[model samples]
Target: MSDRDPSVSDEEWAAFVEAARKDGVGSGSVPEPRRRGFRRRPVRHEPEGWRTGPAWREMNGRGRARRQVKGVVGITLAAGLLLLALRPDLITDRLPEGFGGPGETAPLAAETARPTAPPSSEVFPDHPTLKEPFKGSPALGWANGAAGIEVPRAKAVGGMSSEEVAHALDSVKRFLVAANLDKATLRGERPTGAIKLLDPLQKDVRAYIHRSLDEPDENNDPLGLFSRFDPAEVRLAGDVVKARGRMTFEAGERSGEVQVHVDYTFVYPLVKTRPGFDEVARTVVRRQMAFALYDPAKIMTTRGLLYVLRMDESAGNSDCARDGDGFLHPQFSEDLINAAPLPGGPEIDPYDRSKDLADLPKACGTVTRT
Candidate 1:
């Protein structure tokens, strides 16, 4: 099955020998095949295959070492790439942010996406209902003083009975007092200059009077008179006290007025020199609340407290705290008393002789401060 002229020709062998010599074999060269060969070598057994035979075998070790070096280089390159991908900060030398600065906008977490306010009544089956019922004449109505009332919400909502209004006002005051006290304590503040002067005198005078009168000590005192009294209660007037004043509000570039009359009538339960238990228990709250109102610093504290109370008791113009009787009720919202404006008004006055607040409405923000 071999091809014809199986023996390599002498001329071809000579050319192969010359090529091998040029390739730098020192002395020995490929033998030229006989022109008429004694034994014919196969034609497929060409001289081309002879060049690679011994030289390739001899270089096998160097080739193996080169392959190993390439493999190591590849592994090192792959490891470096892996490290760069895994920990980018290592390559880029930048510290992570501790917390966002004022300039930064931090990415919101998943929890922040949840709703903050509770679902409104429209979404729930059973929820507490709020009431707001008020109406007025659009032209020259309560808001415009055609009728003698000057409440902003009330102008639209109409009038409330004296009892409901008083009760609501008292509740708000109690809540405010507690809040003021808490805020003062949390901020590590002490009584101010005015308070220090008045407070010490008040305590000393009351103590002397009680001792002189031979009042039972608080421990033995069946009646809690001294224990229950607020520091602010002072007899500014006679047994029957009366304070009359007026408040002015600027109504859309116009001014409006409301008359205010405050009366305090003290009842002496069994005209005795000593404090009575009934009096201690019954009047403790009233006395403290009265004192809180007396402080000169709290003149315009009324606005926020009153606003909140009104918003809460919005069931009609009538108050949530009204009784059948006409007289105002006095169930104080213990925490909210001090919020009411102090009786004397703001601390500073240019005219030392000025008797009443010249600009309370402005301070309350009910009207513009012209």
Candidate 2:
């Protein structure tokens, strides 16, 4: 009456039934099979909220790994910030205008006598391009072209009428524009416009200008009166030249004459003549000159023409050891890398217009700023 295999022994069948009964087989529940060399441990009922199971343990391990990774990243970021705070100058010089670097401010009027802060030690600290030729310079805020050369209100001076004084001031401004801002004159060409404004009777001054342009030397430097550059070596970074200064008039030392004084600083941004170069170097030229305006009625002189009395100039960022080539050779970053120390007097701040030209040393000197 048994459904057991007929080939099975009676004792073996009895033992199998006992094992299956112990495992809960045929008791209206499924049973786990027993392996030959393994014994099953008794199962205990665990609480519902217990998370000691295999899946929960794996998830906890992954969470711990994520927390460790986050800790490492946070430590790295803190260290970098600490380094930056400790050594700000490491990156401050390289930062472009605005992200905590030096910012450009509006230019003060040429007549304003306010004092300016000392310039940075680096002459060319910022990387420059044609679009931002005046980068890292105070001249960035200056007026372009002839706008900076402002004339004071004309008034009677040295027995001259207001109309005559106004005419004299206008003529002086015109001569300045032609000599320094004219594109043709800047390209190492003769400044005919400036020369024609001179009085024909001032033979000595006229001859000096002609000689300087024709045969420039240490003594007869044309840069004393004009701002010229060699086209083969460098070119203007942009069409605009930054200029700032003032003009005034006073009674002359002699009778029937007025002395028109012109004091101006010109900034010229230059780049290499070759293609594919973006580096910029600036030359600062400050000219202080006196011109005599004679009244035609009292003195036998041309009414419109100006008489050059005295001229003094100072140039910054130029090659102190250059030959008499009649052109401004600005010292670029590359040129200063391996160049010998310039033999000159103490460092002079070219941008400081507060100091008189006579106060400047009479020898070649280094500059504090470009």
Instruction: Write down the TM-score of every candidate.
Output: 0.14, 0.69
Query: Which runs in model 1 stand beyond 4 Å of their true positions?
Result: 1-158, 183-305, 308-370
- Per-residue lDDT of candidate 2, residues 1-370 (tens digit): 1222234455754564456446553344322211111001111222221111111211322111100000000000000011122224433433333223444344545664424543333222344468987765667767897999998888887888888888889989999999999999999989999999988755545676788799886555677678899989999998989898788888765455777888788988899897887777777787887777777666656767887665667677667557356787776656755766544346566777877666555555455556
RMSD after CA superposition, every candidate: 49.2, 37.6
lDDT of 1: 0.18
lDDT of 1 by residue, 1-370 (tens): 1112324454653454456446644323322211100000111111121111111222321111100000000000000011111223221222111111121222212111213331111110111111100010001011111111112211211133343344333433333222222223112222131122122223322343244225432122211111111122211111211111111211111111111121111111011123331111011000111111111122222221221100000000111122111111111122124333222222221111122222211111111000
How well does candidate 2 score on lDDT at residue 140?
A: 71
Q: Highest TM-score among the candidates is held by which one?
A: 2
CA error at residue 214 for candidate 2, angstroms: 1.1
